[model samples]
Target: MNFVKRAGTSLRARKARTVVLSGIFVVICTLLLGGFLLQAAAARQEADARRTIGVDVTVRGKGLGPAVADRLGRSAPVNRYNPVLPLKAEARGAQPLESDGPKPPGTRTGDRARHFLAVSGVRDSSMLLPFSYGSARITAGRGITPEDSGGQVAVVERRLAERNSLKVGDTVRVRSADHRRTVPLTIVGVFRDPTPDPPRWTPSHELPGNTLYTPVRVAQELGSDAAAVLSEAVFRIGSPEQAERLHAEAERLLGAGTFDFRVNDRAYRDQVRPIQQVGTFAGLIVWVIALAGALILALIVMLQVRERRDELGVLLAMGEKKRKLIGQHLVEVAAVALPAVAVAALAGQLAGQELGDALLDHRQGDVTPGQRQREPVAAGTPRAAVGPPAMDIGPVVLGKVAGIGLGISLVSTAVPGIGILRLHPRSILTHNE
Candidate 1:
């Protein structure tokens, strides 16, 4: 008989062993593929979260001024520096129109009309990013420039422009609480602040309307001397370790009481800790289960070989080569294993997608009331926010799953067949006694 007939006969005679072995192969492939895919999905999510929140170091101080910014610029390995001070300003004249709506008329209308927290000596490096509202772009306008540092130019948020019916080249009036002088700011650019979530304890929710972006000089011209004291300093560092070192050095140079500085290292650690812990435990469980499956399958294959010894010996006595017999058995195992591996890989992919969605929902649900309560709004109305786009499982992940599953199945079949290679024709058939 040919290899196919031989394989069929052997498998039929060992039906119990074949069924048990196939079950074990399926279980092993399922656990390994599922664990790997889930881990990969989690890693992708963590990376995206880190990129979204990009600040490396944030420094806050009472009496910290541009001088501190200058000193840090000179001393620290800073990629960028952002100096910020919060001050109130009255909107003076006509409201700029934003995509969302028109600015409501009030004491906060026009430049002198709205209450704005002005920044003094705003630097290029300090500008916030993704400066656009839902589906809006920062077209036809220029960002805050260094030459405009001491000038009366304003880069208003897109929503602010839409509400007030303001556009590029329009001028808004601003009044300083400390000084009676009114500053007329010509609109230079319209930008967006991606995060609708404002910092804690700030009034006028929705990223603070009447907010104007002007040069540091314009801000200093509007607020008190104490206003020049930098409220916060932002830095973009090259590496996490570098950020930590800079934080420590900043504490030494600026004095701890002078400022509260934080590095992204701690936040990164906190964010990844849960995922790492769970991944570790899950990996351990998967390993244990996979090992158990391999062991069980190994035992089943060995038992099947023992029961088929007579048939194998007869084949050998008929002049069939040892390699051919081994090949036949391998092909039989693969015929059984390949389908199981395919099913396991498909199951893993489906499970990964489900797990990702569940994780996202759980995270969103955990948002505190305080956090959700303070979301930015335009005209006291909430904008329809967009959800994160769906994740695409590309060929890379699918290929990996396919490769891993096939490899596991092959190893499971091959590991216990070494004894099959040593069987002797005479020893088995003649001793069939």
Candidate 2:
């Protein structure tokens, strides 16, 4: 008989068995596909987040000064590192006095005022992040060049510029505690800072605003007492294990007297805690369901063989080869089952994509409340100083999902087929009698 005829006859004779097996295949495929796709997506998202956030080990010491930062910078194990000293200065500018001032004698039309706080002079290795809070884009200017160090040039945040009504090429005055000096900073670039919500003791806004960038040397020049030593160090290691080892080694060498710092691995782990938990749970569920599916399919196929014993005996008696008989049975079951599995897998992928999106959206929204509370509101306004988080999904992530889903389908199907092949037609036929 032709392969199609044999497959059709076998399935028609065992309608109930075919339907049952198909149902099992569908469940197995769905579970496997959904689990793999979601896990892969979660892993990709976690990795991307880690890269964007970066991993850094900060080394600081009360007595170590900036020299320690410089020393660690030369370490071969270090991927990239920069040292910085936090300095405070006042930026003075003239604002047009309100018209009421014109009535007063000797009242200058432009008044000078001072705004104080902290700034930093960081090494070339340390630069502003390219994107933060979507708002921190380079609009209308170049960023601070390495040469700007020790020069009178500064790069201020766009929000800061708008609030102060300052633009590129404007001259502003910066004052150290002991002396007052005016610096003419050409607006080379404006960038948004993607600092996390709630200012965490960093100089810039919790997200990216009201910040300024200038050459490290220029910062030092503004503050004569400014020490040239590095304050913080960032390193990119080959692996998590290497990062851990390097962190420990650096800490040991510096001793407790040096600054306290953290590794990127720790931050990365903490960031993906939720996704990791979800992945673990999904994995467990898939395994349990797939196991049950394999068991059910095997049992259904075995039982169907028993009910077909008379027919199998006749086929054998008619000179039908045992191997052909087995092939026919295999083909019959596979033909019905594989298509069901494929359909279920497609459905599962769609479901997983929707679920993943919802989970991400919910997580992002949940953080908004805490972010608003921690955001620095400009004086006299309830407006949040924080900007929206950056959420960009690239092609690499989609490719990962597709690969994982295909892998799951092959493994889940092949595993059960092995047992199916080992079935003996003669023994099954004899038992049926």
Candidate 3:
């Protein structure tokens, strides 16, 4: 009979032993598959974190104006840019949102007591920290885009809208802080702001609910200066490493040492570092398990060969090639490994979801206590810092597990068979007798 046929017969003859070996193989294969799935998931999450949680570069200088901001924004490294023009304007025929916190001591009672609305003019309202991080969302109409640069438009907070009975398509007039220029802005959109009042006493204009977003041009018109200028402009880059390139570009545009460039990478470090750590950990697990599994199976096969020396001697006496004898042993081990691959694939998929979630949840919270305040937003933002990765068991992972399982089987069988197969047929039979 062929060695393959004889290998099948041997497996059937020792049903109990085969079952025990199969159980061990299943455990080893399951661990290998799980490790691969986790590594793949971590890689995917890291890529997303790089794109969504990018680095923010803030430029501040005396000469940084609308023209310079536009030039820097068009640089190759910048993903998005927002030039802000902040101003204080009096709301005409409308009421600003009130703060629940206590008022400042001895507040003014007459006309001076009324605070001007806090207005923020931007090139793109959606790129602001609040909207990008998702702490704030648009409720109706559209955000103030670049097209509204010179147009008179405004997007108000939902609370401010309710206090003044304002809605989209309604015009609200605002007078400059110097009370020289009065501009009429049509309400383009209304957004919901979850930011709450501070614990300490504060002015109504400084409150979150009283803030307004408008086109940069509107702010420039309402501003006292004839030229359009901004105190600072924010730019987003793909990764923290790209911040250097951006710095160089800014230096080229605005001259080095003249402007203060602040690079904020807190969000990127908080979100991406943990996922990278997890991916590395999973890789270590794969190698350790693969090595240990091969060593264990090799020992088991060695002992089995010693106990079956009589059968090996008899086969050698029958003129069977020693290579065939080794081949038979290898065929049996591989047969057991073949079924374990499928079983492990199923087991891995079932366990990967729970394991992946637990691992990421633990890593995402690995932030230092001191760094919490420095983060762009607090914990309760709409999007999580690092969401759990999807546990997808793709063909690539399956193929890798299968390859490792078979490699383990080959090493286990070959190590023991070579030692015994070297003996002569007469010497092998005499030792058994």
Clashes (N, CA, C under 3 Å) per candidate = 43, 11, 0
The candidate maximizing lDDT is: 3
User: Where in model 1 is the C-alpha error above 4 Å?
Assistant: 1-23, 53-56, 60-82, 86-170, 175-182, 186-217, 220-229, 235-242, 248-260, 264-270, 349-351, 359-362, 365-394, 413-415
> Which scores greater on lDDT, model 1 or model 2?
1
- Per-residue lDDT tens digits for candidate 2, residues 268-298, read 3444465567667667766776566555655
For model 3, residues 318-402, the per-residue Cα lDDT tens digits are: 9888889889888898899989989998887788899888886634333322112123544442232555688888888889988
Q: Candidate 3 regions off by >4 Å?
A: 74-77, 88-117, 124-152, 157-163, 173-184, 191-210, 217-227, 362-385
Q: Tell me the lDDT of candidate 3.
A: 0.81
- How far in Å is the alpha carbon of 378 misplaced in model 1? 29
After aligning candidate 2 to the native by TM-score, how far in Å is the CA of 214 from where it should be?
Answer: 2.7
Backbone clashes in model 2: 11
Q: What local lDDT score does residue 249 receive in model 2, on the 0 to 100 scale?
A: 64
lDDT-superior candidate, 1 or 3: 3
After superposition on all C-alphas, the RMSD of every candidate to the true structure, in Å, is 9.1, 9.0, 5.3
- CA-lDDT, candidates in order: 0.59, 0.52, 0.81
TM-score of each: 0.60, 0.61, 0.79
Order by lDDT, highest first: 3, 1, 2
